[model samples]
Target: MSAFARSFLKKSLLAASTLLLGMPALAEEAASASLSNPFICRRPSGAAGTITEFPLPTEESSPTSITVGPDLNLWFTQTGTGTIGRMTRDGAVTEFPLPTEYSIPQKITPGFDGNLWFTQLGVNQVGRITPKGVVTEFPLPSAGSSPYGIAAGLDGNLWFTQVTGNRIGRITPAGVVTEFPLPTPEAQPTAIALGAGGKLWFTEVRGNKVGAIATDGTLTEYTVPTANAGPSSITLGWDGAMWFTEQFAGKIGRIGADGTITEYALPDANSGPVDITVGPDGALWFVELRGNRVGRITVSGALTEYDVPTAGSQPAGIVFAPPGFLCVDPHLWFTERGSNQLGRIRAVTVP
Candidate 1:
């Protein structure tokens, strides 16, 4: 546990004792309350936005990654159930099964070919699904590469991380595949994103570093400041820098085009921030798997967090939709891995 968490627990115990000494009835209520506060994301009437959730039709589906499709619908991976789920704006859900059983699909993104692509760790293949729900699969160059995170590159191809392959893999829209070896072995990369300057950036969770690959395939890696930080997600921030989450260290990290890295500690050092994205309001938003809350941070380092309505939701992935871009209700979307639900906070546009 972080020192802050230990200290907070100690103080809470002392305060509870004081309350129990005077008022037994009141002390019972206090004792039953959770140590950390939980709130459904909401603001005055229609100000910040209210949170809404849609439960999946199947149990233990374990949805992992979520993305807004070119069709303006939400697409997600059901790792547990081995299916791809699509939800309309009104919460109507449809599921499509992968061709291979035990596919163990991971992160997903809209591809340059007007389709959505995802990683299949269990079957060791890259899968694609058209907007019409047709499925296609391509095997990785090597066996058991464990392709995890994927993103559309500036070169009209898809780029993804090979968690165990120790290399970056790219697949063209035509299904031709190529692999680029990483200088560092066993990096265990987890998530990827297209960042500033048309470069594809990814997290090296085990290597404790962040790497960038130009469309031409030249790769460069920058070391994170903290040891064993376990960076988990990467995104292109509104400020023209690459922002990411340090899951192990409970910090939000930033890397500039020049490869300079900066880190900011969260209010709750044990929050275990997972996936991050750029919100419609131009701030960086992230999911706190351990904190059970969604956090927002500004370019200047100021932070704010809103608790998930479902206790122990264990939010795993997050994505942002711009106001009126495709539909009337723009939202900050996420997957509730623990609760088996998809969630969204109503989005407010900044004039």
Candidate 2:
């Protein structure tokens, strides 16, 4: 066999041996107990596996969103502790608290200005954090806006969703703020993504629709076929379309650039799909908060799931570690909300 296949086989056999020996303790404490050997191959082929329970220092941190920062270190938001965290590829971690009390930081993304930007759900504000951990907060014009999802826009500004304000917002790197009201009041716009043609697409949890807003503030909305689908998070697919999760309807929906809509039902009932991103392998990967599993879905509608070793772990945000900064093998890193750990999925391939 080839070198790659031989290495795969060796790992597979070793994992099988451990399971056959009934070493449940090893699996349970694999990550927290040992940082050097945090990886545990869960599949028989060893081609795909998960590293569970990678302990975060702060207990009950309740990490929400994760992204590869400009510095190439993994940065995430700790909702429970009201802080932002940075983790090195080698597993070292550091956290920075938001200046505003009870800010409830949400999604995070690297801004074009070489800094990290995030949303503050509890207080009506958007925040910017430098690589050196200097944080600055900008208050939204509307009170109780509750901004949730955020993304760097092509217009050199950050676009975000206002869940409580029922609007879309834009903030320049200089902190200038602007807002556009959605036609349907109380639509509860949850997630936002940069769509084709420099437009912004987002999900309306209560309004049961997907909407797009241009850089100049032109808004267009499309109704999802299922009522009260509760669309939560959205990301641009490898196919250049917008793919989103239906948290309440238990389905994944795709919206074409031409405004065509397609919905695929999840095989597992009530999985409660929360966050999604395009994986390193070019498939759409997502977290099932209630179902406690990591799932992958292809553009052609194929679905596969990897069970998280910790039951009720409530896996949250996910992102592919940037190339060359970490291991050669592509890995998907995520947060285990209930367990207060960082999870890793290595060697993921199209099966």
Among residues 3 or more apart in sequence or in different chains, the pairs in candidate 2 whose N, CA or C atoms overlap within 3 Å are none
TM-score of each: 0.85, 0.85
Candidate 2 Cα lDDT to native: 0.82
lDDT of 1 by residue, 205-284 (tens): 99999999998889999999999999999998878899999999999999999999999999888899999987756578
How many residue pairs collide in each prediction? 0, 0
Residue ranges of candidate 1 with Cα displaced over 4 Å: 1-45, 322-330, 347-351
252-347: candidate 2 lDDT, tens digit per residue:
899998888899898875999999987756678888998888888899989888888888889989886543311223478998889888898863
- Residue 247's lDDT within candidate 1 is 97
Q: Whole-model lDDT for model 1 versus the true structure?
A: 0.82
Candidate 1: clashing pairs of residues: none
Name the lDDT value of residue 348 in candidate 1. Answer: 54
TM-score of 1: 0.85
